[model samples]
Target chain A: MKLWHSFLKEMKLSARGFYFYVEILVAVIILVMILFVVPENFRSVEDEYLFYDWPEGVFEEFVLPTLMEDDLDGKIESVEVEGDDILYPAQLIESEGTRYYIFESEEAVLRLTDLDRPKIGAIIRMDEQSQPYYEYYLQGYETQRLRNVYSIFHILDFDLMEAEFESQEVRSLTDGYLELSDRENIVPAMLTFNGSMMGVFIIAAYIFLDKQSGIIKAYAITASSVWQYLMSKVLVVLVSTILSTVIIVVPIMRLQPNYGILFVLLLASGLFSSTLGLVVASFYRNMMQAFGILYFLMIGLMLPAIAYFTPSWNPAWVQWIPTYPLIQAFKETILVNGDIGYVAWVSLGFFIASGILFVFANARYKKTLVS
Target chain B: MIKVSNLYHSYNKDEHYAVKDVSFEVEEGEIFGFLGPSGAGKSTTQNIMTGLLQLQKGNVTVAGYDVKTISNKMFNQIGMSFEESNVYSKLSAKENLEFYRKLFDVETRDPMELLRLVGLHDKADIRAGEFSKGMKHRLTFARSMINNPTLWFLDEPTTGLDPAIASEIKGIIREQNKKGVTIFLTTHNMYIADELCDRVAFIVDGELLLIDSPRNLKLQYGDKLVEVEYIKEGETIKESFSTIQKEDLDKLQEVIGKYEIQTMHTKEATLEEIFIKVTGRELV
Candidate 1:
C-alpha cells in the first residue's frame, strides 16, 4: 500500500512537469508522421529480375524504353551481364522442327525453347531424372520484358540464382544504401528507438527533480525500501512508454503483433532505459549537469535508430549493445513471423541486463541520497 | 529517550573522525540540544541517532532501537526536520505534509492541523517553491510533527526565521516537550538553545566540551562578583568584589557609603560566553 501511494505521488509529480506533456506530444507527432506524413510503399517489379548478357542496343533502345513506358523506371538497381566466361552452361540443339536451349546450374537443369514464339515463358528446375522440383511461368509483358532484357529462357532454381546475385550485391549494399519498405519493419523500429529510448531522459529528469527537492533523502528514511522506490520509478516510465507506444503504433502501423512478446520486450526496454537514467542522474547533483552527459548517452542509445533508418550501416559490433536485441525482437514480433525461441532468448537477455543495471543504479541512488 | 556511548564516525576509513568519541543521554520527554559551529559534527551526531548514518564504532540507541540495526519501522516512531528546508518545493504546503503523512503505517495527524500548528494554515494551498525562507522552515517543522512522533529530531528548526517566527517555533517546541515528546535539537544558535533546550551539549572539533542545562552552565562559568559603579568628586569609579568572601562585603559597604552609586549589577555569563570560554572557539 505504501508502494502504491508512492507510485501515485510520483505519477502526480511527473504529470505536473512540462517534460511529461512534451513527451506525449512528441509521441503523438511521431504517430502522425508514421500515419500521414511518411510516404506509401510502391512495389518495384524490376527488383525481382536478374538481367544477364543482353546486347547494348537491345537494352538501350528497346528494353529501356519499354520499361520506362511500363512505369518501371529505376526499378532495377543493378543488372548482371555475361563476360568472358559463361555464367551458366547452356546446350542449344535443334529438335524435330524447333530449337531448344538447355541451361544447367549446380542445383538443377532448365530447358527452354522459343518454338512457335511462345507468349509465355516457363522457368523449371529439374533433377537428375528430369523430375521437376519447382516451376513458375510469367505471361505476356513480364515474359517479354525479361526475354528482351536478358535473352534468358529459364532460371534453374530461383534460389540458386538469388544466392549468386545476393553474394555480389552484399558488398555494395553494406556501404549504407539499403532502404526498408515494409511499415511493419519501419514502425516498430521507430517506436523502439524514438519512443522507448526517450524514457531515459524523462526518468533522469524526474530523478534530478527529486534530488534537487531533497525528496529522495526523505524517502530513504521512510518505510519505502530503496528497491520499492526504484521499482516505482521504473514502473512509471514503463507504463508511460507502453501507452505512448500503443497510441503511436496500433492506429498508425495497423499491425497485430503478438502482444505477449511485445509487452515483454517493451517492459524490458523500459526497465533498461529507466535504470540507465537512474545511473546517470546519480552522477550529477542537478539536471543541468546531467543534461550534458545525457545528450552524449543519447547518442549511444540511438544506435538502434541509425540501424533502423540505414540498416546497411548497422555494424556487427552494434549487436553488443543491449538495445540491439530489443530492436531485433520488436522487428520479429511486428514485421516477420520470427522464431519464438529467438524472441524468448532476446527477452531473457534484456531481463538479465535490466537486472544488472537495476543493481548498479540502486547502489548509486542510495549513495547519492546519503551523501 | 536517547543514549550514546563512545560513539565515533568518519567519512573515510582511518581518516580523521567527523564525530569523535562522544556520549550523552536524554531522559524521556527531555529536550536535549547539540550545540556546535559548522563542521563540529553536531549534525553528524543527530544523523547517527536518527538512523540516517551508520554508527562506525561504539553504541547509540534511540527509542530502544540500536542506531546501527534499526529498521524502517523505527522511523514510524521518530520524525526528523533537516537543517535545510527539504520540503518538496513543487508541492503545496499541505501536499508536502500529506505526502509524508502516508509514508508510515501509523495513523498520522491531519496535514491541515499540522500546518495550523506551524501558523501556515492561510498558506496551505501555496506551493512551497514560492514561500519565503521562514515559511519554508515553518513548513519543515510542521512536516516533522505529521506523524505525531514520540521522538523528534529538529536540526536548526528556526535558523532563518525572524524573531517573531522563531519565538513561535520555540513555543511549539516547548509545547511538544510538555506533551512528553523527546526532542533531539541540534543548532548553533545559543539563544534558542538557552530558551528551549532543557539540557544543551557544546561540541567542538568533533568532541563534546560541556553538557548541562543553560542555567547550570551559566552558574558554573559566570563570575561570582558584583560590579559597582559610583561617581566620586566629578569622576566615575568602578569596583568589583567577590560576593563569596566576607572581606568583599566590607568593601561593597564602604564603596556605597563613600560615593553616590550610579549603578550596581552582578556579572552573569551568557551561554555564548560560556561556550567560548569552555571550547576556546567562537560559535560562528
Candidate 2:
C-alpha cells in the first residue's frame, strides 16, 4: 500500500511537471512520421545500376530481357549523350518520371558514382569459354540485401534454368515471423530508443530536481524504505514507457506484433534504464553538475542504433551493449516472427542486470540522502 | 527519549571531526534545544541522532532505537522539520501531506488539521512552488507533525518565518510537548531557544560547553547590576553598579543623597550574552 502511494505520488509529479505529456507528445510525433512521412516501401534498385559493356551489346542480351520478363521494361530507357551533359552526369536521368541513364564508358560510370551515390557498375567481357564473365564495380556503402538483389538480377541466363529454380525451397527458422516492410522494420527501433530510454533521461533529471529541492533529505527520516522509493520510480517509468510503446505500436502494427513479449521486453529495458539513471544521478549534487555526464551516457546508449539500422556492420563489441539485445528483442517481438529464444534470453539478461544495478543504485541513493 | 554518548562524526574519516565527543540527553516530554553557531556541529549531531547521518563513532538512541540499527518502525515514531523548505513543489500542500502520511504505518493526523495548525489551511490546494518562503517553511513544519510523532526533531523550524507565523509554530510545538512529545530543537536563534527550551546546550567548534535551563544560565553567568542615570552639575551622568557589591551599594546611596536622580533600572543578561560568555563566540 505504501509503495502504491509512492507510485501515485511519482505519477502526479510527472503529470504536473509535464514530463508525462512530453513523452506522449514524442510518441504521437513518431507515430505521425511513421504513418505519413516515412515511405511504405523503399523502391528496389534493380534498374538503378549503371552498366558499361566492352562489346556494348550486353545490356540488350542480359538487362533488357530481365526487365522485359519482370514487366518493368517501360521503367528503363537507353539514352545517347555527348558534350557537357557528360561533365555533369546524373546517376538516374528522369524523363516523364522514368529512369533513363546512358553509360558511355567505364570513365563515365566512375564519374557517375564519384558523386558519392550507391551505384553498381558492371564490366562485361568474353571469357575463354566464349560466354560472358562480368567484373562488377560497386560503391562500398550498398547494403548486403541490395548487393544480393543486384547479383541475382544480373546473373539471369538465356537458358531459362526454370528446372534449377523449381528445385529450391524457402523456409523460415521461426514459427510466427512474418516479412516486415521498411516502415514496419523501424517500429522496434523507435520503441527501444524512444520508449525504453525515456526513463533514463527523466529519472536522472527528477533525482537532480529532488536533490536540489531537498526532498530526498525530507524522505530520509520517513518510514518508507529506500527500496520502496527506488521501485516506485522504476515502476512509474515502466508504465510510462509501456504507454508510449502502445501508442506507437497499436496504431500502426495493430495485433500483428506480440504485445505480451513486447511489454515484458520494455519493462526490462525501462527498469535497466531507470536504475542506471539512479546510479548516475547519485554521484552528482544537481543537474548542472550532472548534465555533461548524462548526455555522454545518452550518446553511448545511442551507439547501438547504428548497428540496428546497418545489420552488415555488426561488430562483436556492439553485441555487448545492453541495448543491442533490447533492440533485437524489440524487433523480434514487433516483427512477430522474431526468434523467441533470442528474445527470452535477452529479456532474462536485462532482468538480472537491472536487479544488480537496482541494488547498487539503492545503496548509492541511501548515501546520497544523508549527504 | 533521546541519548547520545561519545558521539564523533568526521566528514573525511580522519582525525578532523565535524562533531567531536558530543553527549547529551532529552527526557520524555521535555523540549531540549541545541544552540550553536554555523558549522558548530549542531546539525551534524542532530543528523546522527535522527539517523540521517550514519553512526560513525557514537552511541545514540532515539525513543529506544539505536541509531546504528534504526528501522522503519522507529521512523514511524519520529518527526523531523528541516531548516530549509523541502516539500515537493509540484504537489499541492494537502497532497504533499497526504503523500507523506501514507509512509507511516501508525495512525496519522488529518492533512487539513496539520495545514490549519501551520496557518496554511486556505492555501492547501495551491502548489508549494507558488508559495512564499515562509509558507513553504510552515508547510514543512506541518508535514513533520503528520505522523503525530512521539520524538520530534525540529531544525530551525521558525528561522525564516515572520513573528506571527513563528509564534504559531512555537505554540504548536508547546502544545505537542504538552501532549507528551519530546522535542529535540536545533537552532542558533537565542530568543526562540530561550522562550521555548526547558534546557539549551551551548556548543561551539564541535564541542559542548554547557547545558542548563535559560534562567539558570542567566543567574550563573549574568552580573546582577543596576544602572543609575542622574543629573550632576548640569551634566547628565550614567553609571552601572553591581547590586551585590557593598561598596557600590554605598556609592549608590551616596549618589541618591548627593545628586538629582533621573532614572534607575535593573539590568539582566540575555541568553545570547550567556552563550557568548560560555563559548566566547557569537551564534552567527
Candidate 3:
C-alpha cells in the first residue's frame, strides 16, 4: 500500500510537468506520421521497361497484350520500344536476328522487363545456347517471377526447346519469393527503435526531476523502501512506454501481435532503461552531466536501429547489444508467431543487467542522501 | 528527550572534524538552542541528532533510541525542518503538507490547520515555488509540525521571515514547548535564541564553548553596573557604578543628593555581546 501511494504520488507529480504532455504529444505525432504520412511518402518504386529495336507492331501485338493478359498494367508503368538506336535505358535489346536481354545495374534485370517470356504464339527463334544468359538474368528477381516467366515460355513450348529446364526450378523460385515478400519484419524494427528508445529520456528525466526537487530524500525518511521507490519509477515509465507503443502500433500497423509477449518484452526494455536512468541520475548531480552521458549511452543503445533500417550495413557485433535480441524477438513474435526461447533468454539478460544497475543506484542513492 | 556525548563527525578520513566532540542535552519540554556561526558544525550536529547523518564517534540518542540505530518509527516522532527549504517547489502548500502527512502511520495534524498556524492559510493553493523566501520558510515550519512530533528539529526557523511572522513562529514554538515538545533549534541569530530558548549552547569550530540558560550566561558575562542620569547646573550629567560593591551604593546616593536624578537604569548585556565576549569572535 505504501508503494502504491508512492507510485501515485510520483505519477501525479510527473503529470503536472510539461514533459509529460510533450511525451504524449510526441507519441501521438509519431503515430500520426506512421498512419497518415509514411505510406504516402513511401510509395513503391515504379517498374520501368525498355524494349530496344523492336518491331513497331510488336508492342501492340505481343508485349502490351501479354501485360494486359497478366493483369500487370498497373505494375508496369510504361513499356517503350525504341527503333535501331540504343539511346533509351533498355534492359533488353534485339540486334542481328538475336533477341538478347542484357543484365544491367550489376545484376540480372528480370522483374521490371517486358521480356519475361515471348508471347504464346511468338516464334522461338533464339539459339538454345543463349539459355545461360537467361538463367543468369533469372536469378535477379527471385523464383516466383522466374516461374511466371517460365510458365509463359512453357505455353510457347520454349522449355521443350531447352532440355536444361525442369519443374524443380519452379518450386525453388516459389520458396525464394516467400522469403523476400515477408512484410512483418518492418513492424518489430519500428517498435524497437521508436518504442523502446523513448524510455531512456522519459525515465532519465523523471529521476533527475525528483532528485533535483529533493523528493527522493523525503522518500528515504518515509516507510517506503528504496526498492519500492525505484520500482515505482520503473513501473511508471513502463506504463508510459506501453501506452506510446500502443498508440503507434494499433492504428498504424493494425497488427495483433501476441500482446502478452510484447508487453513482457517492452517491460524488460523499460526496466533496463529505467535502471540505467537511475544509475546515471545517481552518479551525476546535475542534468547537464547526466544528459552528456545519456547521449553517449543512447548512441550505443540505438545502434540496433541502424540494423533495423539498413540490414546490409548491419555488423555482426550489433547482435551483442542488449536491444538486439529484443528487436529480434519482436520480429519473431509479430511476424511468424515463433517460439519465445530467444525472448526469454534476452529477458533474463535484461533482468540481470537491471538488477546490477539497481543495486548500484540504490547504493548511490543512500550515499547522496547522507551527503 | 535528546542527549549527546563526545559526538564527532568529519566528511573526510582523518581530516578535521566538522563536529568535534560536541556534547549537549535537552530536557523534555525545553527549547534548546544550538548557537553557532556558519561553518560552526551547528547543522552537522543537528543532522546527526535527526538521523540524517550517521554518528561517527560518540553516543547520541533522540527519544531514547541511539541515533545510529534510529528507525522510521523514531523518525515519525521527530520532525525536522532543514536550514534550506526542502519543500516540494512544484506542489502547493497544502499539497506538500498533505503528502508528508500520509507518509507517517500516526494521525497527523490537518494540513490546513498547520498552514493557518504558520499564517499561510490564505496562500494554501499557491505553488510553493512561487512563494517568497519568508513564505517558503513558514511553509517549511508548518511541514515540520504535521506529525505533531515530540522532538522537533528546526534550523534557522525564522531566518528570512518578517518581524510579525517571526514573532508568530516564536509563539508557536513556545506553544509547542508548552505541550511538551522538545525543540532542538540551531541558529546564528542570538536574538531568537535569547528570546525562545530555555537554554542555549554556544559552539564554535565544532567545539562547545558554554551551555547555560540565556539569563545566566548574560549575568555571568555582562558587567554588573547601574547608570544614573541627572541634571546639575542646568546641564545633564551621567554616572555609572558597579552594583556589586557597597561603595557603589554610596556613589549612587551622592549623585542623587547632589543633583536631581532624571533617569536610572541597570545595564544588561545583549546575547550577541555575551556570545562575542565569550567566543572572542563575531556571530557572523
Steric clash pairs (candidate 2)? A176-A337, A177-A337
lDDT of 1 at B219: 87
Worst 10 residues of 1 chain A by lDDT: A107-116
- Tens digits of per-residue lDDT, candidate 1, B58-168, equal 899888888777677888888888778878787899988888888888888999888888889999999998999889989988888877789999899988898888888
TM-score of the second chain of model 3 compared to its true counterpart:
0.97
Q: Given candidate 1, what's the lDDT at residue A324? A: 74
| Poorly placed runs, candidate 2 (over 4 Å) | A44-100, A103-167, A174-176, B233-235, B256-261
Error of 1 at A160 (Å): 16
Candidate 1's docking class is: acceptable
For residues A25-56, could you state the per-residue lDDT of candidate 2 as single tens digits?
99999999999998887665443335545455
For each candidate, the alpha-carbon lDDT, in order, equals 0.75, 0.84, 0.73
Q: Write the per-residue lDDT of candidate 1 for residues A1-371, one digit (tens) a residue.
A: 77787788778777776777777888888878766766666433221111223334543565345344434233422322232343444433332332223333322221122221242233433467645343433434454566554444343665688788888843542343333455545676676766678888988888877777777777776656777887888888887888888877788545556667877888878788888888888788888888888988888766866776676678988877766777777776664455557678887877887899899987776555656
List where candidate 1 sits over 4 angstroms from the true fold: A42-184, A288-296, A308-316, A336-341, B229-239, B255-262
Q: Write the per-residue lDDT of candidate 2 for residues B177-237, one digit (tens) a residue.
A: 9999999999999999999999999999999889999999988988899999999999999
**Leading candidate by DockQ:** 2
Query: How much is the lDDT of residue A92 in candidate 2?
Result: 41
lDDT of 3 by residue, B136-243 (tens): 888888888888899988889988888998899999999999999999899999999999999999999999999999999878888899888999999998889899
iRMSD, all candidates:
1.8, 1.0, 2.2
For candidate 1, please provide the TM-score of chain A on its own: 0.64
What order do you get sorting by lDDT, best first? Answer: 2, 1, 3
DockQ of each two-chain model:
0.37, 0.79, 0.31
